[model samples]
Target: MRLTVIGCAGSFPGPDSPASCYLLEADHEGRTWRILLDLGNGALGTLQRFIDPLGVDAVLLSHLHPDHCMDLCGFYVMRSYHPNGAAPPIPVWGPAGTAEQLAAAYGLEDMPGMRATFDFRRYPDAPAGQIGPFSFTATEVVHPVPAYALRVSVGEKVLTFSGDSGPCPALVEAARDADLFLAEASFREVDDNPPDLHLTGRQAGETATAAGARHLVLTHIPAWFDVDTAEDEARAAYDGPLDRARSGAVFDL
Candidate 1:
């Protein structure tokens, strides 16, 4: 399995980072399976830079926030107008209101060419099921909107993605024993203004330690925060391999 960080910015996009998006690819035999964790703002273009836009087989949304799901419109356009127009609809998986949210985002209950463009599937808070080579479980998180952190297992390797959330036990349990934990360290400890929605670097590290994750990759950090200092704070709490995520960073698992 290969994990690619297409974007890793917080709240809004930064000059250097786009937003929140991760691509996971698994190759078995001669077949390839592609999955996207979140398609945040401007991630469609960023995705084109790494892999073919049509190559994506499935999209899983973490939440309805613009920074997490706004790029589906761009993806719709690509699936509708690209030279390879006959491509099959990609399966979109997400939390309960996913279908409605996509309809509202595009301003159409049944938009033109939408049925032909996407095979939409709404997943509940429980273990939904499998998609190709991966199986996953979703747990609700504490966020303004309905959000879920996913635990994905491909073969024997497991990876957890904390979309965006405050420090919560659901996240810790969902990521337990994960080979790689991609968590959000969206704010510095001192900058805890809207304190209940995002996690600080220290909080993220503690979560990683408690989950027993082999490696922790801190993401969703604002551009203004000192990256080195945030990493140091996490290191103080987590003794495992800890690192700050950068745009375009790729991990092979």
Candidate 2:
């Protein structure tokens, strides 16, 4: 299994990093499965730099926020204009109103340019079974908007993503014993004390410790915060191997 950080900025796209997006790929029995965790603003372009967009098999959206989904419009354009006729429909999993939210965001229901692009399968906040080689489960998180943290299992290796959340037991429980925990460290401990919508570095570390994750990858730090300081804070709490994610960083598990 391989995990790639396509983008890691929080709230909005920074000069150095784009918004939230992660790609996970695995191959089993001669079949390749490519899954995108989030497609935040400007991520489509960054994705193109690493992998063929047409190779993406699935997309799991964490929320309806623009920074996390704006580049879905770019995806629509690619599917629409591909010279090899229309591509097969890709499974899109998200919160309850995924279809409506995406249609509205890309004007798909109303815009002809977006409507005929791809097929969409919207799943509510429930266990929606499996997608190819991955089994998935969603847990609600504390955020201004309805957000979900996802647990994805492929064979014996399980990975969890904390998609824009505050300290919550659901996240800890969902990520229990995960091989890789991709957590958001959007703020420093001092500034984000009692964080409302996002996790601080220390909070992320604590979550990884409690969940017993083998590897902790911290992401979503704002450009304003010193990256070194945030990493140190997380390190203070977590004794295990910790990595501060950077754009284009790849992890092989």
Candidate 3:
């Protein structure tokens, strides 16, 4: 499986990167199947630089925050009214009311919404299942809105994605023994940031250490925060390969 960082900025789009979005791809039955993790603000444009919008097979959203899901509206436009024709309804897994939230964003609450282009399925209620070559499990995380962290495995390699979470036991469980852990470090370790909203770099590192993750990729950093400081703080808590996620970065597992 290969993971591509389409965007990793937090809260909002950054100068160098868009908001939270990722692309995961793996070969299944002699064909590569693509899965998009989050289609956040400004990510649709950036995503085109990586792969065709129509080629994505499925989408998994962490929450309804604009930075984590606003681009789905733009994507709906692409899938609904392409020059060729309307594409097939791609499966989408997200928290409860995901379909409604996207409908409101697209100003289609009274219309067809994204139903014509997306097959929406609420998470937690949707049992862990196979999407092409990958098997994934979603666990609720600590966030103001409905959010979840995910553990996805292909063959013997497992990858965990911490979708904008603060320090939480569920995050540790989701990332447990993962070969690669993509964690959010939105807050500074020394700041007096509130709890259960976002994780500090140190907190991210601690979670990875506790989960015994082999490699850590710090992501979802806001533009204001210094990546160097976050990396330093994370290194103090974790003793493994660590890298700050950047747009266009790729990891082959």
Candidate 4:
């Protein structure tokens, strides 16, 4: 399995990267299957550079926040009206009412609204399922909105994504024994921590340690914070292989 970082900026776009987006791909039976973890603001355009936007097999949205899902509007435009031909409906797994939230984001009526370009599936019903060669499980995390963290496994290799979560037991469970933990570090330990929204770099490291993750990749560092400082904080807590998430970085597992 291969994981590609499309964007790593938190809350909004930064000078170096866009919001949050990650691509996970695997090969099985002589065919490659690709899935996108999130499509945040400014991510769709950047995604086109990495892979054909219309070629992704599926998309899994962490939440409805603009920084995490606004690019779906632009993606809809691409899949629905590509001059050559409209792309087939792709499976989109997200929270409840995702269809309505996306419709609102696109400023459309209750009818149609991206349903033509994407097949929307709400989570928790079949939270643990298979997508091509990968098996994935979703668990509710401590975020202000209805958000989830994902654990995807191909054979024995596991990749866990802490999709916009604070310190929560669900996160720990989701990341247990993960090969790589793509955690969000949007807040600072010294800053006035908000309630049930984001995690500090130290907290992210601790979570990785608690879950026994092999490698830790700190992502979602907002532009306001120093990236080096966040890495330092995480290093103080985690003794494993640690690195900050950067656009275009690729990991093989």
On residues 1-253, what C-alpha lDDT tens digit does candidate 2 reach at each position? Answer: 7899999988788887789999998986688889898899989989998999999988888888888887888897787668987777787777766667777876656444343554455546355557678788888889888888989888889889999999999999988999999999887867626546888888899999999999899998888888887789899889999998888999987
Against the true structure, candidate 4 reaches a TM-score of: 0.98
Which residue pairs in model 3 clash with each other? none
- List model 1 lDDT by residue over 1-253, tens digit each: 8999999998778888888999999986678888999999978888889999788888888888989988998888788887855678888877777767777888877444366788776667444668789888778898888788988888999999999998989999988999999999887877635855988889899999999999999999877877776788799899998877888999988
**True-structure RMSD, every candidate:** 1.7, 2.0, 0.9, 0.9
Off by over 4 Å in 4: none
Model 2: weakest 10-residue lDDT segment is: 110-119
lDDT of 3 by residue, 58-79 (tens): 9999888999999999999898
Tens-digit per-residue lDDT, 12-117, candidate 4: 9999898999999999888899999999999998898988888899999888888889899999999889999999999999999888989988898867877988
- Evaluate model 3: give its lDDT: 0.92
Give candidate 2's total backbone clashes. 0
TM-score of each: 0.94, 0.92, 0.98, 0.98
* Per-prediction tally of clashes: 0, 0, 0, 0
Better of 2 and 3 by TM-score: 3
Clashing pairs in 1: none
